[model samples]
Target: MTTHIPAAAKIVADLKARFFPTPTYRQLQLEFDLLLEQRRANLRQGRQQEVRGLLVVAPSGAGKTTLVARVLRQHPSGLRMLTEGEERADIVSMVVPSPATPKGVGLDMLEALGYPLRRDRSAHIIWQLVKTQFAQRQVLFLHLDEAQDFSRHNNHNDRHAVISTLKSLTQSPQWPVGLILSGTPELLDLVNMDAQLARRLKPVEHRPLKTSVDGGMITAALRQYAAAADITLDDALCKPRFVHRLVHAADYCFGILVEMICEAIGEVLLAGEDILSTKSFVTCFSRRSGCPEGLNPFVVEDFLALDVRRLLQPEPGPGNQGRPR
Candidate 1:
């Protein structure tokens, strides 16, 4: 039997698939292509060289992870089918485990490569296996998201060890793989602690959005998404004041802004509404943020005065910690 999917769900999924390639995404994609090409060139020439890596630094909601994933998915040589049941990916993507020790990250990489450890192993041994697996899989890039966790360690030696492991991965003579380290801006301090590592990494930053600069783009995105949802946006919803409030509501993060637009569109679609209005956004904000109409940026007169960022924070209660609303 075929299960029926809700129209709202289908529309939301379609909306998400429409990627808005911001200038920052384009720049990062170009840099990634260049790095991959360089690696390919060196391999073809049989030259033994250390591979350089990218350090992507952005705020929590800037969509760094999504941007990187899209780039990997679009690359021509990013994936390969080795056999009927075996596949090899050019990039092995994983999140850096909390505490961010060498052993933790090494084991995480091994698991992502589909080779989980079967027995207890030392940090040294685990990393050796990780390198071996990476080479065996013919992986070209190792992407570690949330890499800022590396700096959570207060011990000087511990932090240095993590940095050293990353350095060793790129410099491994037998299988030098490029690295993609993406995290918040705090990751810069972690990388800079070791001068050699800092020099070897290319830094790419995703800046927050500004109403004056990004208003047109945001408006276009809203219209595009609304049309995809078969809803017509109200004229007043695209006004400068409403646009500014929308930006404020999203905390000036591009990813969050796109999500807010989609959320508003989803609300309209689900509500059986043909015309999207500011009230739709007001309802969306109230539902997601658990804020009353008075405090919501979409409903408030002076949106800039409201700390919309705080709306995403969880209330103090059982089963509510660390979860928005």
Candidate 2:
């Protein structure tokens, strides 16, 4: 028996596959290319040397993960392959586990390298296995997403150990591995904890979107996404005022802006409508934020006054104001 998927789900999936090459993405691509070039140069010179890694710091919903995934996917030697029943991976990617410790992260890395631990092991043993697995798999680049969890420890020594382990990965004499550490802004503090580590990582940050600067891009995205879904956007919805409100509704994040556009398109498509309008966006925003019509930027007259960043948070308790969930 075959199962049928809804038209809305298909459209949403297609929309999610689309990528916008923003300035940040271009910068990330250039940095990745440079890192790969350094690796090649080292190989040509027949020298074992440490290579610089990337430190990508951004706020929540800034598309850091998407950007890194795209870069890795496009690289020539990024994917794993099976040759003669042997697995070889040039890139190994994993998310840093919460409450990240050196041991926990080391175990996660080993697992990502297809060498899951059979039993509990010391941090030292786990990392030694990780380094061995990295070399065995021919993994050159290690991408750790949500890496800010490494700083969650209250003990200064524990945090220092995490930083040291990351530094050591890029400086391993036998097989130096390039690192791609992406996380929230706090990750910067983690890197800065050690001066040597800070110097080894090339930092790339994702800045918040500016309404005046990004308005045109956001407008184009709306039209492009609607056209992709075979829906025409209403003229009023593309006006500058609405575009600004749309940016605000997305909390000035590029990824969130794209998501909102896709959501609005899905709403229209699922409703058997051919035209995309403010009502579609209003419905999508309401569904995502659970905000009342009066507080919704897409539905209100004074949208600028709405604290969109707080829209998804529950109401504040007495004296505890404007806290996020």
Candidate 3:
């Protein structure tokens, strides 16, 4: 016996490969290009440059990591440095550890650079290794995501120490690595404290869409994605009520908005439906958010001013064991 697959399912699979590069993605790409050019010039000239860092700042789900990672792919590493005559990385990327400290950050970088640390050592020793390995590998660019985590557990003095470590990497006379730091807005605190650090790093900010500012863009994108999936765009989905509700449900996050749309589309495909409907979205929202039908924005009437925070709260359920407050 042969199993049948729905046409909508095939379309959904095709849609998975689609990437709609928004204005923010383009802007970030342009910034990365300029920075790469400067780094190239420095490598060719054999000198450290004044502007050696770039920071991409955005909220939790503004797609900072996705955008930066995509840009990083465009600049593949593992090239030989002309002066050093060794295998060198054009760009190396890693995430800042949660509850970050100077030492943890060093280990993260060392690991990303493929260094082994079998023995226990001090932060100073690890960091020394990091700088030495960076020079040896001829790494010209370093990209750190979730950079705000660096400030999570740091006090004033500790924060300054972390900042100093970052500054020194770019200040190296030999093999100065251009830094790309991407994180939430709080990452700005790392630079604001030091005037020189602030001056050396350029900032690229990404923000979410608001009903007033990005309503048209959001609507157009939704329609485009629907058409690509060979599904009819639900009229309710195009209305202001549903659009803003989606924005709110996604915490005003662009990445999450995309996710919500994709998940809803997937649900329609699974249901073997030809038209995307508010009911499909309602089911998706309830399943993901754990909100009841009355509170589900997709289903509820007079949901204009509904606060979505309740959906984000953890409630006891089949998979979760109750804990005393």
Candidate number with greatest lDDT: 2
Better of 1 and 2 by TM-score: 2
lDDT of each: 0.81, 0.82, 0.75
Please, what is the TM-score per model? 0.88, 0.89, 0.83
Error of 2 at 195 (Å): 1.4
Residue range with the least summed lDDT across 10 consecutive positions in model 2: 316-325
lDDT by residue (60-134, candidate 2, tens digit) is: 888999999888887665555323346677777888887688887787767666678954789888988888877
lDDT of 1 by residue, 228-323 (tens): 888898999778899888888888788988888888887777777778889889988988888666568887676676667666544335753332
Clashing pairs in 1: none
Residue by residue across 42-91, what tens digits does model 3's lDDT show? Answer: 66887666446888888877788888877777545433332223356666
RMSD of 2: 3.8
Q: Best-fitting candidate, measured by TM-score?
A: 2
Q: What is the TM-score (0 to 1) of candidate 1?
A: 0.88
Task: Name the lDDT of candidate 3.
Answer: 0.75
Residue 112, candidate 2: how far off, in angstroms? Answer: 2.7
- Count clashing residue pairs per candidate: 0, 0, 0
